[model samples]
Target chain A: MIARLLKKNHSTEYEELLEQIAQGQPLPTDELEDETRPMAQAANWLAQRRAALDPRPGYVRASRQRLVARLQARGGKRPWLHRHWGDIAWWQHPLAHLALVMLLVASAFLSASRLAVASRAWLPGDLLYPLKPMAEQAALLASLTKEGDAQLHIEFAHRRLIEAQSLVFENRYEQLPAAVADFDRHVSQAVILVNQMAGDQQDEARSLATELQQALSGQMGMLMLLTNLTPDASQAEFQRLLMISEDGVSDLRNVLTPDGGDAQHQGWKVTPRVSMHWLGEG
Target chain B: MPDRQHADETRLVQQAQKGDVEAFGQLYEFYAPLVFRFLFSHLDDRLDAEDLTEDVFMRVWEALPGFRARGVPFGGYLFRVARNALYDHYRRNRRRSSDAELNLEWEDNFHPDPAESVPMNIEHGELRASLAKLREDYRTVLTLRFLVGLSTEEIAVAMRRSAGAVRVLQHRALLSLRQELERQESEENDRQTFKEEPLNGV
Candidate 1:
């Protein structure tokens, strides 16, 4: 009952107690009926707050000498490469962040370029990468980590396109279209996988990434598939559709005829030539 | 003036507010131990208390020149700034911590034995954990009255309130502290193999 009374009248009772303490009187026995111990708690609170605001005696002096030279320069505009010097009370210059950020970007670029030119990097994972045709495509893999899955797929597709070029030079149309078809299918599959994963989390940025991944994957897939599977000409008839030479002779003549028959002369490899259809300008 | 120290303290505040670093440093040295004791009681970690003490002076140095030379005692203005800074620091750090992390952060380091020298080394952090649990009124009153050694009149000026109001806050703050202490004691009893330990080692 007294506890409830104290709760109801606690604020007034608090004042009465402080007055009593200040006057050097023990809390009245009636007021002490419910709460006699709130005294030290308030004492502690004030003390703690005070301590946090005041540390060692001369810390201000210590920081003054440290900040004096930097303070002089910041009176106008600060130098870009100088220390951040984070004091808003003195310098409210808006250009501070802009200069700092630009310097950061430029220095980062220079450091990356210098390291790229001067550094010799060896990775333990390089030994495992040569086993896959897709893996053989990424020249940048040995140097960095941020290329992500989409870049990896693009690198692989471009590599397969290079391989198709070799087949075109060799007149290997049958194998060339099949390789293009494989690249198309994988890229399309990767696209559908991303599309299936959209709208999952609250992070719109990540969701947008899924959308981009799906769209690019589909575009890449269609490019490969359309070039290989379009029905304008029969698989063998494509041999006469050679854009490499305007004579429109069969690819075998170029490979077998003595005038141009030297397969090793133009760095050409011997293969069937079904790779004539290219959806892209490449 | 040489004898009373109180009159001298007022003079120092006027000089400190005029950008005298030495005057501010004198106030810091005089009040640092008193502040630490209060922080040590409220927070359980000695290091955090020490850090906040340092931070308080750092902020005082920055804000002192702008501080108005109002007729109220300088200690009240100084501690009021310090108190507000503590709350701001808590608010900022709260955003960076998860629920579990906050619980861990707020864990009290006060032991059953007052003589336990280990935790008092970093008294401020430990006290903050306990202080965070208090109601705002209780926190303000308690901090102003006991910790900062503000008279009721001084607290009145800083809080923009009547001395009666500050006294009431002091009372309510103490009640809350008692309740908090009791609740913690019971909770500690329920935990298995729980032993009293100070968070800050001597």
Candidate 2:
């Protein structure tokens, strides 16, 4: 039966000898000389070499004891968590460990998202205020597509402007700088993202640019009012921020109507609620 | 007999995975010789092989916790670790200018019985030298199959190859060794013939 199987499966000369061995038949001497001689010689040489330098029994015992000692030392010093959790049969399952890792990652993401939402209402003086910008940055990172990125930046700019207004109203003078910085960053990011839009998206981009210019013009009017309310030391900084916002509004207007059309005629003029000295007039 | 030993090893592996040091020690006793023979044959140096054998077991101990049977026998896993350790050893040695020198201190640490050492002959030395000349994969397969006494199926698991591939490698390795031996014989005969021929000046 073995010979038949060998004949079917293998076409090698050694198949006959293997079949013979399987059937308890002696290997013919001539067949051995013709086919198996070299292989037998090589196998014999390897076996002799293996036996010649087999590790001494004493060395083997010492090595085994050393390994055991090492393992025991490791086990003794292992942390309580590893010791308790490592041996649990379910914990040893690969899929179980994978699920545990996935659960940890999901919970971490959830906690970060919740923290981000709660941090949005914080003022600069609050501990979580710093997380607000981090949250905005996270939002920007999430909106990687070109289509939504400009809108996301513009939304964040509006949020920052509102935050600046609240900080000014509350007389939180120390927080004003961070709020102004956040507003500036959001406006700049919106401009850059809008400018990066493809030629086919020009009409939508121009509309978004016009909206940003109007929003910045409105925020400048509020900042001018806040500048008057600000103390002498902070007053100059607020005026500087107003000038920067005014310049940003002009840059967006230029991007929208690059051929230099009449501001009112082009419908890009935003009526400033508070009249102030035009920084661009100088 | 092999089936019984494999069953025993599987039980021991399960115990070792649970941090049973004694069971791991028994495993070490059982597998150390097989690993040593494989490394010794490939490296062609007894001391280097022994050191690498110890290193292999150390890694095995560290990794045993994450080891699942996954249809591969424990011996297969152990040898795979041994093979990787040997590869790392070779890579490190390649970066250094000095090859790993035989550690003479090994003899001082453990002395084998005089009777245990097989007397080396010219033919054995030639065969060892030729084996070293074979490609690493060929040498490895041949050592695992013959010197380590692993069956083709076990070698397939250890090497992560099909059993048929292992057989083909074995056959090719044997043929290459035969060719090397024949070439050496022809060269020896040429030298002998030249020596026996009288010089024209003489």
Candidate 3:
């Protein structure tokens, strides 16, 4: 009965023995019962064979040379794009280079135009609507001068006001807060741009500021029309939009005015007013 | 591999992926012999083994961009590439069966000195016969484990089996090999005794 039980557990015991042997531990034949001794011996023999099976040195050397040569030859055959001189060669051909440049510009302009047209009618929840803000940003960034910058920001502010009204018109109250925030940001960005102008650019800044003020006044009137239509779920966001537009109009008024002898407004300078939330804290 | 060597291999693989032929050459130096031996055991033809080993590395170079060091050890990946190349070789040659095609013979061309060459001996023939008698998976497990000196985990990846399964298979294979060798030894001994006994009677 004892021998039978030990024999029954011998397979598990042999697995353990195999693990030890695999780790290069010597087989403990004295401790192992007869059932696993043959397996242990066989494992040792296999390990011995593993030790003896070394490839000839001459073959390894010759094979290495051949492989290295082949690898080098193949590596040399790769196209100019993979070579070190690839960058220089890429722009060396005058006609091909001109064609490549033309192709890239044409593709970029075509894609941008298509995206703009498709996204023009897209509203807050539409799939391509996100591209609208991104395109506005790209346009804003591409403007090299402060006048263009302020103009782009005013245009984007108008777009946001339109988007917000469309959301209200479409009963998309959940999207109103994002549109309000975007409108406030664009308006603030425009105000900051016009205010940062130097003394020499004050006249230009004043002109841009007047255009922005007109745009904001039109947007404010449109926003007030939205108040009656906006639901309670989006009342807080609509109120925030109204406050932003009121502050924007007031700031523009201050920018457009200067006391005849007041030193502070001589250079078309007035400190920017604290926002409504900040005023509430005060 | 130890952590140090594995780290170095990862670095080399990264460089090779960027078309660094010198770094790939170093990798070939380290693994080429083992790969050649692995193919030789199956091909029994040195030139074929050499060609297939080169083919495997070429394929590896082409596929290097997609190789993720985190997925499998470089050694395991190389062997998998070698095994696939070997299968492709057999397929292209219109072989009947892959297992039946294992023509493992000792390379008699191996020479300690240029003036003399070793010849194939009887023990190698017997060993080859013994290996030939084993099942295909059994033969592969033994060749990869013993001849190639792959760790169990590496063998598992190369064979596409679990480490535990490889261990079990290895254990069974060794035991079976031992039984076959002992049976052959017994028959040889019996024949020797019978021939000597006839001489004694004369």
Candidate 4:
């Protein structure tokens, strides 16, 4: 009740006084009735205080110079790389420069890896064919253990078979010879590496060799069909590829079975469905 | 202010962002007094205010690179920095003393224009003493509004309050200040009466 009475009594008078002060108007003595005189006097006192409180000129000048000098000093201490790498003195810190170079090299290798992945579908005569094998070689180099090497070689041989088929379909006869050579090289490398394995790895190597032989037999059948359909000029090349694949299959079976007994009993022979159609006529 | 002057200040801020020390120095010159006034009013100590003013600008220099203007006036942003610096000063110095006296050294330096002088009997020492007794928010709003000449909207921006809230605070500050002055006067009158009664007893 008392607070409400005070607000009702003083709100208008106080508002007018504050407005006058805010507007930089002269406080009115004529309008000051006895009850409002204290407020008027307070407003005038505040105005006088504001006018009297100008910042000393010398202090302002010193603070500005000090702040500017401090800023310039801070700017000067920033590393050259943070400021700009164009400075020749960036090499002054050898480790930092080396780190920068390593970063750039890492970025370039990452980009190349992406490009190589994108080039996976490219055929022998395509612009990105070189990158395909380079990528394969990189994968092979990354895994140089005996089993890993054998597995990668088989993978590359499978890739070569696919490329040879693609070349035959595209009538890219000139590149088929190179593709066949690559296929034979990978299959031979996979068999030789598998044979060199010791005790526990021998069974794993035999299983991988069997899988490789089966893939080769399938490729050989495809080559036989392609040879039959190809014109006379390219028929010999496809026939050669078929022979190379058949020889690869025979070599894998010999490596797996090692005896002259029935290779089918040892489960090293190509399936009947794969070899029967091509071999029966031959 | 004229739009051209505002444009010039904006340009200066942009240059400061790009590590232009001269541009930043220009900003320092223009804002140092206002900042010093704010610190002086808040700290009420000349040396601490001066040191804290320097601290505020040094912070500004370090933080300028990341400071995006958006639509806030540079003055409002600067006062915000000043406010935070004062808060830090208080937090650091709060346990030491509660001396709330304003430095009146500037009174000696004040040279009012001859024509503008209206001689009044208001005792400035008692007025300052009353102002010092006010709540911190009340004193701050009064200083930002009257001493620093910020508009209510600008005070709202600097203080992070609504403009209506700032107006209410300003009114209350004025009322509280007047009431304090009245209290002081009544106490003085009582002291005078006590002294006269003792003389009568004698």
Descending-TM-score candidate ranking: 2, 3, 4, 1
Residue-level lDDT of model 1, residues A159-211, one tens digit each, is 45444544554555555544554454334333322322322422432343333
Better of 3 and 4 by DockQ: 4
By the DockQ metric, which is better: model 1 or model 3?
Answer: 3
Candidate 2 segments whose C-alpha is farther than 4 A from its true place: A1-37, A76-282, B1-7, B95-118, B121-127, B194-202
lDDT of 3 by residue, B11-63 (tens): 88899878788788878877887787677656554566777888888777777
* Whole-model Cα lDDT of every candidate shown, in order: 0.45, 0.63, 0.64, 0.64
Q: Which DockQ value does candidate 3 get?
A: 0.09
Better candidate number, 1 or 4, judged by TM-score? 4
Residue B50, candidate 4: C-alpha displacement in angstroms: 0.5
Write down the worst ten-residue block by lDDT for model 1 chain B: B96-105
What's candidate 2's DockQ score?
A: 0.13
Report how large a share of the reference interface contacts model 1 reproduces. 0.15
Can you write out model 1's per-residue Cα lDDT over B104-170, one digit (the tens) per residue?
3444343444554334433545455556687545655666565555578877665544453344445
Candidate 2 fnat reads 0.29
| Global local distance difference test of model 3 | 0.64
